[model samples]
Target chain A: MIGNPQSVAPEPSFRDFSKLCVHTITTKPWSVEEAAEHFAMSGIGGITVWRDALANRNIYQIGQLLRDHNLSIVSLCRGGFFPNLEAAGRQAAIDDNRRAIDEAAELGAPHVVLVCGAVPGQPLTESRKQIRDGIAALMPHAEASGVRLAIEPLHPMYADNRSAINTLGQANDMAEELNSPFVGVAVDVYHLWWDPDLEKEIARCGKNGHLYAFHICDWKTPTLDLLNDRGLMGEGCINVRQIRSWVEAAGFNGFNEVEIFSNRYWAEDQAEFLEKIKHGYLYHS
Target chain B: MIGNPQSVAPEPSFRDFSKLCVHTITTKPWSVEEAAEHFAMSGIGGITVWRDALANRNIYQIGQLLRDHNLSIVSLCRGGFFPNLEAAGRQAAIDDNRRAIDEAAELGAPHVVLVCGAVPGQPLTESRKQIRDGIAALMPHAEASGVRLAIEPLHPMYADNRSAINTLGQANDMAEELNSPFVGVAVDVYHLWWDPDLEKEIARCGKNGHLYAFHICDWKTPTLDLLNDRGLMGEGCINVRQIRSWVEAAGFNGFNEVEIFSNRYWAEDQAEFLEKIKHGYLYHS
Candidate 1:
């Protein structure tokens, strides 16, 4: 159980898009309206909206538009970049997070994913402290909005500027320290696949009822760009099926969210890419 | 101490290149012969020769030439790519490793660093098992040659094709499991700097006498190329000096080997680059 979790659970079959969810950023070329139309047309179950996608649009109307298409608002793309050097900056981040929570509440989304930032030269230890303080400050606002906060630990390659919390273990520790029902963890396959302790940590967070969201994508072998160049599920080496089994075993009956950021795929017709995602979902994931 | 090891150790000042070593791959433009002469002229203390740099060279004579230049032959650059899909491929890798051990012994190097390879489609657990078996197979030969095998954990970005061992904890675990004096771990800042468990694992390996080598380099803020694009010391966000303090505090009295693979630096005058390495070694490292 400790070392070989994959062996204990047989591979689960995925027949349709009932549990499939696509992030707005995955098909970056599409407008939110277009994405909602296409996702609903393709029978995709849900959509995670990036903050940018909601720009210049009436958020309430946009939520209505998505619901009109029968799309469940999975979660807001991001809200955390909480670590900052100055008190003003930290306060600004808290304010922004509060707004994100408000937006999520209005959008009928359940949670806001936290990228939990790191400053370039700031010690990760200090950045982590700032992240904790920022999250604590936002808890009251989040509770009032009836929105949960999902702390998404980024890849270690992004540790310099993207996140101080680079492991699920760290995210779990922070969530437990805060001891809030409004705070939890997001499990992203692309970021956490390489970790040896992933299974144990997944179980740990799940058992504590802190597993809020699950995101899926593949790690391309020759990842050309650090921030982009993510592969579709079947294109890379990650055993997504095995990891999905771990998540399902942990009592996460949520969407198998497809969250990819790829310049190559974005340049193509997103409708075609959506078909590929479904194919990958059925056979590879 | 459990979380912030850097705050516990004071930064040590480096006055000279007496403990500085450079890997041959750092100056890829130079031949081993050219690297030896230039490194000696620059008063660099040691050189770790990459296997590619040894092409068609007389190993014994190369060792003699390095000694003549008053350069300590540090551990050979690499010897492991143990994980393979086929038994024949695995056997072939072991044979190559044995040959690498022979070359290291002939080159008067004390150890050979292992990259511990992974196949794109292989599960990391299976690859790790193959790595352990491959290393175990080489232990007797390594001991006979009075040469050690230092398992160098690569960055997790390389988990697809480069190396399955991506954390110092994993490397330390493998080395201890192999349970041979000829088996040990190499600490590289570029690969392990982002790990939260780094300090504890460094102390663990050092206490067990399994910490065999220490490599130094910086991770660029915007790492352009996955294979190359390494930064000079002080060029990126990694706390190279702080990590060095931890390595030293863990009772490692080995050379601070500068190992960079940057396409940008290789395009520069290597003699000038050597001067920068000396400066970075003194002030940044």
Candidate 2:
């Protein structure tokens, strides 16, 4: 059953960072070591590591470093770009995803979030099939490594190239079809806040036990860029707290991941930005 | 019944300008008079006049001028902003919409396109209800004037402020619920090309006799600006001809309205830009 009705879903009131997680890319100015140190000092509960942060570093030592700070390794940033015009290209993507899964395992992250890809000008139907198949191919490796896959349905504005999966319903459908315990969904409010069926889809995902992660970010009214212009919670129109209530009602008791890509925020002192994020989380989210 | 399965929908071959209609805003550099003369001289079949172009002009005379060039007046550019937080503001929106319908009547256009509005941070359900009520309020006036209302579903990105109705399915639902011949939905590729259910929804509107208008434009990758960054037909990833095929198969033979809003394109020589549109239409569309 879909837990509490949206109308009666209890409003969440968080006074601490007990469930707060920040993505490495959100504070793009900081290195992973610096982010881990600052986040731990700030009492942030978890960290979702972007793969870019692992470049030329010892993944295992970095994982240990995060553990030393008592930071939970929530997820690896991303791992999917499965669709391509050529078979070899798709295989390359799958290989890259496999490396991502391995990296997640090494980093002690439980899941690898997938930003399911789309080929511009290609039929979405075809890209979607490729995504499903690509995930299917990675199932064995994922299961073996104990790193789950969370399909993050991107906003439709990104449908041309970033992702073919643009709704939680689509992500739920894919997850249900894949039917793997290792496969689930990452509910990001930024991409899905506009959907009328959002509450229903959240319930469906929760009922089916496919809701694996929760990501939060706000959508600015005049979103200046197609990418990297995301607003922090309370700075834009999204009802993040209301959405959190929906997620909680759906039985998702996981990290409330703050994953933002903002040129404006990145230009600021990241330590100061992190403090603002905490303020927004406590008051708005 | 849906007219055609997407797989079997025939490829449209538009080798002439008979079904081509250009929106006044598409060539932003040109004055209404200049756009009318050039579009007519270029053998464009129709024109959709934006309200800005009618600022101080005699509406009836402009209608006559368009007709004198043998150009069919397709529809008035826009007319819906029904959702407002304040009741008086909502009433003002309805009043303004009534004026838009009257303008359409005087301009000799068959319908007024509705960009059914949204208020940032307002629950979409409330905004949607207001939109329905506002449209219903205009029904008597629209019917009496012999001018129809075409509900234009904006892209989901615009749902924050531009429109609460952001899908063909939503527009179709409103039109069916309104159940008036004077009320229908406009299918714009720029707003809806990313929808997986687009073909089915197009057919649904067609079957329900609610398909009132068809607008064409492309979505560029790395779309720098949220608004005013649209592409010409072949310049972006949209399968314009395929969607047109679906529209045609749905029993619609209306003008294919070219509605592009681009700061990049506005800086160009508009007459030359007009040539590109025709070429894009003949080949890409």
Candidate 3:
């Protein structure tokens, strides 16, 4: 297929926010209550709450508050980091994940996204095994709480400490190995837009019923920070609409979750940033 | 083999610099003549000349100078950036690569390591195609000059503007598809340590006679820059010794090329840095 002409379809026009979802971390300045109120007022359809946003709050009441605004609760922000050098640390990670799952269930979210962890000096092969084992340990609690776990394979830049699962193929492989409806993969564009096998892997996951969630963001050319330098949908090099088309073609018809982590955007007036997001969504996503 | 135990063999002790090769850019501060003097004084075996390091000098004489110093001209630093929005731009890149081949031939280097390029905002698939075509177009020239081309897949973080080939597996696929004896893949630990299929792909390339070069460096836990900020061998999390075992097991009996681009190291005294490189090679690599 060298030099063969391959082109994704043109961007689809989004006429409404009926399927739009905003991650609370995308606007880090906002509290969960504030985000819910603003997102609801802005006609956004969904909200994916970061676990930190639920700090010291009544989880059920927060779920009710979001529902009262007619917002569908998407997946919780994060729930994995299972790899550790010590057995006690790994067990602690599992326990924390269980708590995250319980919180997700209480918040009436359907799933919890996992940033499967990696230890700095540990071999990635070993870290991956631990991630799988940790997920297996949490499967019973997850099933009981009716909360799915979406494995979010991070970018390779994060392989040192953030995640051992750095490609969608790896995530799909793990999800299939786990073999549970409650265990699936979350397709995050920031982590996966660079992958050559992304389209094929997306199709595979969709066919196997493991495509559970989709996260949207752009990859800034000069990505300044490994953690917080993500661009808005249309502001960077990622062809977000094209990836979304691939996801939709692969049978994913869920919220187009906007999950950006940008210090620049956070420093801005969040209401204005949210407006830009809405515009970016309507035009770029 | 989802959760299989993969124990790489123990690190082999290096007693000499017989197979040690350092890229000129790794020292950055040293001129080619200065580098030759320092390397020869340190009893280093080989040197990979970055194109910029050869500016304003007679290429053939530079080769002879290095030969007089008893240094093997390992390979030319780089020669690929094939992807461009304009056909004219791609042609310019191909022409530039041809010039690189000529330079390598004149410099008595056996090969040119290609950091195959990607255009920002262009689809990576397109960039990859351009890279393949660019290499194909240069095959006759490369053959005529008796020089090889080594496809060096960069890290995914550089996939935006550096190279679309982000994994050794992808580079292997490209090299196999090109099917030219003059074209092979370079295994760089800095670029590929995160890949799950790395060992298998290395083995495949070795069996197919496509493993041409092996570049060594460590990935820092907090990689500060996308272009620079690489760690010395044992200073970071990369299991350089383990990867070296895999490369050796795959039948690679070539130079353990130390190719680090670090602003931190570059700022240090060049002579002091050379000493550290020697230690890093003998111990960490």
- In order, the first chain's TM-score in every candidate is 0.95, 0.95, 0.95
DockQ of 2: 0.74
Model 3 ranges with Cα > 4 A deviation:
A1-14, B1-14
- Name the runs in model 1 displaced over 4 angstroms: A1-14, B1-14
User: Which pairs of residues have clashing backbones in candidate 2?
Assistant: none
Q: What is the TM-score of each candidate against the true structure?
A: 0.95, 0.95, 0.95
Number of the top-ranking candidate, with lDDT as the measure = 2
Give lDDT tens digits, candidate 2, residues B1-285. Answer: 334332232244535797899999998778889989999999999999999999999999999999999999999989998999999999999999999999999999999999999999889999999999999999999999999999999999999999999999999999999999899999999999989999999999999889999999898887888888999888888998899999999999999999999998899999889989987887677
User: How much lDDT does each candidate structure score?
Assistant: 0.91, 0.92, 0.91
Question: Residue B177, candidate 3: how far off, in angstroms?
Answer: 1.7
lDDT of 1 by residue, B71-98 (tens): 9999897988999899999999999999
Candidate achieving higher lDDT, 2 or 3: 2
TM-score of chain B of 1: 0.95
Q: What tens-digit string does per-residue lDDT give for candidate 2 at A222-254?
A: 888878899988888898989999999999999
